[model samples]
Structure formats: structure tokens, C-alpha cells
Target: MTLEAIFGMASLLAIFSWIALFIFYPSKWIYQTLFSGVLIVLGIMYLFYLFTGIGSLADFNFDSLEQVRTVFSSDEALLAGWIHYLAFDLFVGMWISKDSWEKNISRWVLLPCLLFTFMMGPIGLMLYFIVRAIKTKKLNQSPFH
Candidate 1:
């Protein structure tokens, strides 16, 4: 498949997953399906493209911005990079949903966080943290733990 086609499919799937979360908040099946299904599929695509593209990259390295730019210059590598963002951002969004549910945070409040996350990953996460701190009153709680 062409990179463009793959990109479109991935984007659509991500959007569908996000919508599912919004509609089916706190549903176990939704979480399982997204985590075990969509995430795994994206992970496989990420690995396939990363491996396939890295071998052909003459200057593949993460030592500097220029090296990273060179690595992503190719279509395959660029697609893989984009997929990486999609997968991780989706994962973060899912985490936000789950955590909000646990903290009794309202879905109405989560909408912006999820939307920002889908559009720009970290900003949404930061927004979530702020909301979480206010709602749960646990400012020091680490998201990782």
C-alpha cells in the first residue's frame, strides 16, 4: 500500500477509536478493543515500517535534530514516525479516559483534553494533569505510578 493510503487508514482508525471512547466511556470492551486491537495493529505497522525504512537510511541516528530529520526524510520512515505519534497519542488519550473515570472526572470536562490530545499530544496530557489535580486534589500523583 502507498504511504498516503496507509496514513489515511490509520487516521480514520484513530478517529474512530477516539469517538468510541467518547461514546462508550468506562466500557471494558472499548478499552480492551482499543488497547489489544488498535494499539497492537499500530505497533505492528510501526515496527514493520521502522525496520524496513531504517535499513535503507544512510545516516540513521538519534544523536541530533539533523540526524532525526534525515531519518524521517524518506517516505517510509516518515510514515512510521507519524504512526508512532498516532499510536502513543491514542494510548495517552485512553489513559486519560480511564484515569478520569477513576477519579470521577466528568466526560464533559474530558472532551477538550481528548480533542487536544488527538490534535496535539502533549498539550492534552498537560491539560489532563491540570484537570486531574483540580478534581482529585492529588497534585503530586505521578501519571506513571
Candidate 2:
């Protein structure tokens, strides 16, 4: 099998593992570790493919639905990549929404995080961590943990 095919299968397996972790044990350390590790590894592999030109990471050439359909039908690896993209992206959105609601963070701030998460994945998560750190700093100044 080609490197692309192997990577594609790995991506799909990671997504399924994440879904299983969430379903079987909702909010636990193991779930977090598994999900984050899988996501990070898949993301790094995607970047490697993009930079090394082993495979196309984004659909930059397809301009029409017919073209997209043909590509997907002809390319199993591309289909797997699409599945990984959707799975991780939707999970990122859901994570931001759930965490924001639980923390009682303002909806205004959360809305941009949700949008960025959909568009930029880990960048959005990094921004959220920055915001959380700043908030925690300010709160701690007021005699809280």
C-alpha cells in the first residue's frame, strides 16, 4: 500500500477511537489523552503530507460538484481524509461549545472560538488556552485559586 493509504487508514482509526472513547467514558482523563494525542498525531501527519507533497491535503483544484464527486469516487485516500477532517472539526466545535458553557464564559467570546475552531482547528484551541490563562491570572489576583 501507498504511504497515503496508510496515513488515511490511520486517520480513520484515530477518529473512530475518539468516538469510542467519548461514548464509553465521557469526561475522563483517558478520553482527553486519547483524543488529544490522536488529533495531534493526525494533524502532524497531515502537515507532513502537505509540506512534502506526498498527497494533496486540501481540495484546491476541484471547482464544481461533479469534479468533487469524481475525485472522491476515484480516490479512497481522499475520502478517508475528508472523514478525518469532518470528524475532528465537528468535535472541536462541540468541545468549545461544551467547555464554554460549563465555564459560564461569555457567549460572545465563545462564538469566535467556535468559528475559529471550525476554520483552524488547533489554532483555535491554542487561542482558547491563552484566553483561559489570562482569565485565570486575573481571577487569581482577586484571591481565588
Candidate 3:
């Protein structure tokens, strides 16, 4: 296959793996392992692309982000990327929301989770953990403890 097609396939696979983890195994060790493995595979594929000089995956110069943005702005790539992003991030948000509910966390905290998924992908997961930690600390500090 052409390099661009290979890269696109690899990207799609990585995204699907992430979605599976989020939908089926969120917060579990198996999920973590699977997600990490997917990332490693993606990294290796990217390295292969870089070494082969077939096409640029990411360029480190000042215009790198703009370059990526431009590529993603195309109709086909944008549609595909948006599909991948929304499917995975929505699952992530749902997982976080479920975790919060399990911990008896207030629903208000979920707003940020939704925002994070829509805007920053995994950053929302990190924010969820941070909020969870804060809530846990408060619980521990309570007189009932």
C-alpha cells in the first residue's frame, strides 16, 4: 500500500483500539495495557514513516501544527478524524461519568469531563482523576471518616 494509505490505516486502527478500551474496559488494567500497546504500535509506525521518508507524520518546526491543521481540514481527512475523535472521546466521557457516579461524585463535575473529551481528548481523563483525588481528600477529611 502507499505510505499515506498505510499511515491512515494505522491511525484508524489506533483509534478503534482506543474506542474498544473505552467502551468495554474503562479504568481496568486490561484497558490500560491495551491502550498502551496501541500507542506503542502507533509510535513504531510513525517511526517507520519518519525513517523511510515516505511522508511527514509530524514536523517539529514552527509551522508543524498549522501543517497538521491544514491536512485535517480537507473534507475526507476531516471527516475521518472527526469520526475517530468523537467516537473515542464520547466513550471516554461516558466512562468518566460512570466512574464519578460509582464514587458518588456530584454531577456538576461531569461538565468538565464532557468539555475535555470534546476539546482536548485524554486531558479530560487526567482532569477527571484530579477531581476525583480532590473529592477523595475531602471525603477523608470529613468528620464521618
Candidate 4:
């Protein structure tokens, strides 16, 4: 498949996973499907691209922004990087959803956090932290706590 098609598929999969979380909150099947079905698939793709496209890590070091940019100069490397972001962000979103459910945080309040997490990973997580702190009335060491 073309890289563009792969990107589109991954994006849609993540979106459907998020929607499933809303529809099936706290379901083991949903978590399993996301982790095994979505994340693992994405991980395999990431490895394939990283090994086949990026190749020899000795040639690249992420010690600086320029180095990072150099590594992502290849389209394959860029796609791998983008997939990395998509997978991790979706994982983080899943964590947030599960955690919020455990904490009894309303889904209405979580919508924005999830949306922000989808568009901008850290920003959505930060928003979740704020929401969590406000909802729980205490800032804990771990997000899960």
C-alpha cells in the first residue's frame, strides 16, 4: 500500500478506537482489541519501517533537533515517526479513558481532552491532568492513582 493510504488507515483506526471507548467504557474486549489489534499492528508497521526504511541507527543520533530532522528526512522515516506518534497518542488516550472511568470523571468533560490528545498529544494529556486535578481535588504522583 502507498504511504498515504497507510496513514489514512491508521488515522481512521485510531478514531474508531476512540469512539469505541465512548461506547464501551471499561470493557475488557475494547482494551484487548485496541492493544492487540490496533497497537500491535501499528508496532509491527513501525518496526518494519524503522528497520527497512531508516536502517542503521548508528548513522543517526537524536541528540539534537537537526539530528532528528535529518533522520526524518526520508519519507519512510517520517511515516514511521508519524505512526509512532499515532500509536502512542492512542495508547495514552486509552489510558486516560480507562483512568477517567475509574475515577468517575464524566465523559462529557473528557471529550475535549480526548480531542486535544488526538490533535496534539501532550496538550490533551495536560488538559486531562487539569481535569483530573479539578475532579479529584488532589494532584497525585501517578496519573493512574
Q: Which predicted model would earn the best lDDT?
A: 1
Report the candidate with higher lDDT, 2 versus 4.
4
> Which digits, one per residue and each the tens of the lDDT, describe model 2 over residues 1-145?
7866765677566556545543433255644665577666666665544444423546434689876564455344454455457557756655655565556666667656655665678887777666655655543222123
Evaluate residue 40 in candidate 3 and report its C-alpha lDDT on the 0 to 100 scale. 56
lDDT of the candidates, in the order given: 0.91, 0.57, 0.58, 0.86
Model 2 clash pairs are none
TM per candidate: 0.93, 0.43, 0.44, 0.93
Alpha-carbon lDDT of model 4: 0.86
- Looking at model 2, residue 82 earns an lDDT score of 53
Q: Tens-digit lDDT track for model 3 on 33-91?
A: 55566545555554454434423445322467876676555444544454456546655
The runs of at least 3 residues in candidate 3 whose Cα sits more than 4 Å from the true structure, single-residue gaps closed, are 1-74, 138-145
Q: Give the per-residue lDDT digits (tens) of candidate 4, residues 22-140.
A: 77867889999999899998998888877666678885689999988888888888888988998999999999989999989998998899989988999999999999988888877
- Model 2: lDDT of residue 75: 46
Off by over 4 Å in 1: 56-59
Q: Candidate 1 lDDT, tens digit per residue, 98-120?
A: 99998889999999999999999
